[model samples]
Target: MAKTTKTGRPISLDSVKANQVIELLKSGHYMQTALEVAGMPRSTVYAWMNGTRAQNSRKIQDFVDTIKKANAEAEQALVQVVRTAALGYTVERVKQKFVNQQNEQGEWVPVMVEQEIIRETKRDWQAAMTILERRWPDRWGRRPPTINHEENEVTSEDLPEDFL
Candidate 1:
């Protein structure tokens, strides 16, 4: 027998579906999209996380913990990517090529070989500026210039000659 929610909807506590959702979440998919891709209802997952449903089994609790861990991992990965963008980094690109080679059986065979190419990404000035401004707003953020209202007050005497 399967567990049902208060609304009589079957709670899909399938580990495979949960793992699929976790993987999707780790890949930066939003909760709704992940649930949809995993063939699970958004309400079911949210209810498991919120413990709003009557099904308070150990499986549900474990599923909730797994979801939280997956979310944290995704967030950490995103933060690392942002930090890397703020500070330039290098990446390795791999390419595979097929070449004809003589095999031990005295026959020509196609062999696949991998070639790695290193690439350097330049730091993004905008990303760096944004990080600096947000992290140290008092020093790097833009602020409106201070004006002395009493000294800069305008009067009718200062009007242009074209004005009556």
Candidate 2:
């Protein structure tokens, strides 16, 4: 038997509600949204994760670890998507078309034919720039040009006497 709150909600990490929340998180859902979708209170979940409710429980620790793993998986997936967008890709589209043809019986018949279309997507320059800037900030990132006031400044002594 698992522990439950007064309202009959399971407090254990292995509960169905917890698993639902975990799956939602793994699928890239936000924490609040996952909790809401799973019918779990955000406050309670936060309390468990932060160790405010069950500070010394092994189950709580396991739950926190699982949430972290799910979030990491989601982040990895997002990174892969961004990388793919930056590099661009080719996609094949399949379509079914109906063509009118004359059969051996001299009757016009509708025939279904499949067509494959290949599409090439151009690379996203902005996304590539973003990746470059993040991966090599010192080399690709934008920065203000450095200026030396003393070197560029012109004084009366350095100027021509007649002009001063």
Candidate 3:
């Protein structure tokens, strides 16, 4: 029931497309692409998002919070998925079938052999741990220790300044 602009399009804030745009944005879509997906104009979307029109600052802040929450949840979920993949990896003895030459002829033969094969999940786990460490450096990151030698250190100041 909102008035249409001179271009015969309803104001973005008052139109149903606002929710569509917001939903796309919350799901990690870029602003321009999200609005494009919703078939809305960039100027209208920016106006509403920037609080240039009837929409106020608080609404824009809520949109920002939604995007942040989505990001955090995605990060946590990524770590969890990677952890599961990594933990499932194990080095174990596995029987593998291979084609090998077993005669004077060039014919190939199938041989069953047992060997130690490392599961690929180990790499996935390491990757997950790396990502987690990078994301939460304080909790899972490595910090080079700062060692001080003040007590047992010799001071250059005690040396003669004219030693040169």
Candidate 4:
């Protein structure tokens, strides 16, 4: 058998089989069809799908591995673009989607990013409050009472008896 470099190195027998399975799957081969064609056990295929099996008899594993690699590359590229370029006139904002999960207490909760932002905003508000306190010293330690100037205005009839 003539051996050649398939992916920068000699392709192993298992890898070749995995590639064959992937091709068959992409060509509309169903699980049952692949099982019969590959002559591998059904449990083995399932294990490969879940990444428990190290060997590549199941074609789905190969597809999943490829997808993971592609996702990582895409994330890296996006990070590079954001790091190298400065924001234009309009600020770029991204809305993150969080999946709710149950805790040990069985209560659903938001992801960590939401919690982190809340903490950051609270810290910022506290800092602003400290700055305000420095700028305006309160007379009574509590916030200065808000007074309405309109209520204190004196009408002509209310002038002192001496003036009238």
Summarize candidate 3's per-residue lDDT along 43-120 as a digit string, tens digits. Answer: 765665466756445655565465456556656666676776766656556656666757668677876565556554
Q: How many backbone clashes does every candidate have?
A: 0, 0, 1, 0
Q: Pick the candidate with the highest TM-score.
A: 2
lDDT of 2: 0.83
Q: After aligning candidate 3 to the native by TM-score, how far in Å is the CA of 105 from where it should be?
A: 45
Report the poorest 10 consecutive residues by lDDT, candidate 3.
6-15
lDDT of 2 by residue, 1-164 (tens): 99875644556654788889889999999999998988878897798777777446677777779999999999889778778888997776667688999999999999988666767676777778887898899999999988899888877888887995
Q: Candidates' TM-scores?
A: 0.58, 0.62, 0.37, 0.25
Off by over 4 Å in 2: 1-14, 93-100, 110-121, 130-164
lDDT of 3: 0.64
Model 4 spans > 4 angstroms off? 1-13, 52-164
Off by more than 4 A, model 1: 1-10, 90-121, 132-164
Pairs that clash in candidate 2:
none
